[model samples]
Target: MRVMKLNEVINITGLSRSSIYAYMAKGVFPKPIQLGPRAVAWVEEEIQGWLQVRLDERS
Candidate 1:
């Protein structure tokens, strides 16, 4: 249930900042929770599940 910041997301997912936002725009990535007027964070479980799906696809 932890929240992940953009840099953490990038490091964990191996995706560029633009790519992550692009995927979100395309509705293919998990959306971040708005924390405030100037901040947002994604659910860690959601990102982990997304990664698991990708890993499953590779198998």
Candidate 2:
């Protein structure tokens, strides 16, 4: 169970920081877990699952 930082998520998903937040706001992306007063990270498995869904949609 690994947690990924914002930059890692951006690289893996090829989404800009604003786009990731926008998708979250639209309820179409996984939310991040608050790690501290100003830190957050996403579960690696959730991100991978989201990616799988996108791939499946293309099939």
Candidate 3:
């Protein structure tokens, strides 16, 4: 499974931190996996697919 941190996700998704968190809260985004006491990351493939879906929807 591919995984990435918040910063990388933000850069790739072009979504603001607040918007990313908001999407998660609304159950529209991938839930992050905790990698440490305070570190978390999303599954890379899932996020990528999510982005693809967003693009497809837009088109």
* Model 3 alpha-carbon drift over 4 Å, by segment: none
The residue-level lDDT of candidate 2 at 46 comes to 95
Order of models, best lDDT first: 2, 1, 3
lDDT to native, each model: 0.98, 0.99, 0.95
Give the per-residue lDDT of model 3 (tens digit) for 1-59: 78899999999999999999999999999999999999999999999999999999998
For candidate 1, the per-residue lDDT at 3 reads: 100
Sort by TM-score, top down from the best: 2, 1, 3
Instruction: Please provide TM-scores, in order, for all candidate models, with all chains considered together.
Output: 0.97, 0.98, 0.92
Look at candidate 2 and give me any clashing residue pairs: none
Model 1 stretches astray by more than 4 angstroms: none
lDDT-superior candidate, 2 or 3: 2
Tens digit of lDDT per residue, candidate 2, span 1-59? 89999999999999999999999999999999999999999999999999999999999
lDDT of 2: 0.99
